[model samples]
Target: MTVSSTSPSAQSSATRTQTSAAVSVSSETALPTSETKQAILTQPLFVYNPEYIAFLNKSLATRSPEEILEWALISLPGLVQTTAFGLTGLVILDMINKIRNRRQLAEHPVPLIFIDTLYHFQETLDVAKRASEKYDAPLQVYHPQGHDNVASFESHHGQELWKTDADVYDYVVKVEPGRRAAIENNAQVLITGRRRSQGASRAAIPILEIDSGVTPAVLKLNVLADWDYARVWKYVQENGVPYNVLHDRNYKSIGDWHSTQPTAESEGERDGRWKGEAKTECGLHKDYFKMRANYLAAAKKRKLTESTDFVLVDSEEPSSKKIDS
Candidate 1:
């Protein structure tokens, strides 16, 4: 049985400031690559707790990505796959299709949740839409409240909030909406597309993580945590997965056009994201409470300049007309 994480708002393990709730990672022991057939039948360990780590070390490490995901489907009732339709995400989406078609999965084996920041490149939107239609995924899309368009988003958060304050931008566009999606859907597990080879921030990404960083700390299972970029691309190409078009333009990791850029041939997959900055993971994979606090602080600062506290009344317009409204 799992206990409440350190913070009530725990969403990811990164949120816990306290050390007790944190499910620590150890590179000391490398898990086996493949498991025997007998292990597949065993019920996965602790769908809600950090004990999932023991399951990974003992059973899941030896399984294929497809098998691991299958076990997750059976183990996690509130399982939802969050994707940006990147190569890794698309690859898993393809795997889900294969599993559902071959095996007798329930009507909705796993639902797909997406955060539409409303500032994504046109190609990114097209790719997401295409993947949804192609796979017949039970898709749930969440966007920034009251700012579904660029103009409204800028008006409220200031023009290009990401440029001014990346934390606030991330909270408004990704973290808050992600938490809202989890709450609205009653989702307990978030199947992420993260891989260990993504770089430093993800260097220690485990297959199962108890993320107690949002309300009701979410369980995150990175199916492709062991796979590298080359392997991920291999699976996508071999499976004919529908991926984002921007990847064709040397853009390895694509987010909003303003924040993301094409990577040099020598860089890693995520190097393209939050380019020129030290940022690696988006707010989606980070601690939710800290992100919220940071965003609130940043927004308060912006209010000083952006707040319409003393707008000059248009004296040219009729005073009576303005007053009545």
Candidate 2:
């Protein structure tokens, strides 16, 4: 599963060629504004037309995951894989490695982005490190802003913040970090691990989707959207991909430690995640605008409460001083 690294000189030459190609395309395109032209030159070319997207989904529905991935590597620029080191994600990572080998690529064509969330199990983190090294994939890890460890996070946000305010907690830990990772990496197309077998919102996902939730909307490629749990597992076992050891303990879908649990064999794959709650997809896949709005509102209310408490405490201190005098 090793993809050799390209020489620095070769990478620079490739970059220059890509930049020149983008400039040529921008010149030919009749963009209305200079800003639009600049954007086209800087970002990967993607058509947001609904008709084209629909056609792509219809055409790709019957393709194998490997075929879909190979197509994506060639067609999509700024491509990256976002994973939690889950089984399905591991399978995709392995497949991408094989594809890179087949194409005789100097390095893994697609990079990987992993949002730590600062609350994942130790086993998950271990798998992330092991998988990245084994696949020789470029891995970029992101976590919540200003908080490196659980203790620091708790000191500011309070203990068990998920229980106190689930939405805010998720926004700070997972959604915000995940968004930051994509933006920082300039990712235009994201290879995700979601499959229809997971059920809920994922049951009807298309092979390709325009995720307009982020500031700069990105393409979400569900290469394995049509794959089932058994198929995914088979690939994992056959490829000997590294995965979270918790899966062997019946923890089907792993996320934050507090919210995740082991499920019964009869339960759905994601039943272990957010147990007893209706939250299937974390804020990462939800409407980014809505999540941001909710987080800002909650933050504002908390700040106001803190300010009022400070005023109350200051007034009480004056009264206590007067009494002492």
For model 1, residues 135-183, the per-residue Cα lDDT tens digits are 7765677677555578877767668777777887887788777776666
Question: Best TM-score goes to which candidate?
Answer: 2
lDDT of each: 0.67, 0.71
Model 1 collision count: 13
TM-score, one value per model:
0.77, 0.79
Please give the lDDT score at residue 162 for candidate 1. Answer: 79
lDDT per residue for candidate 2 within 197-279, as digits (tens), equals 89999999899887767524368899889888888888888878888999899988898888889999899999988888878
- For model 2, the stretches where C-alpha displacement exceeds 4 angstroms are 1-45, 215-217, 304-325
Residue-level error in angstroms, candidate 1, position 1: 8.5
lDDT of 1: 0.67
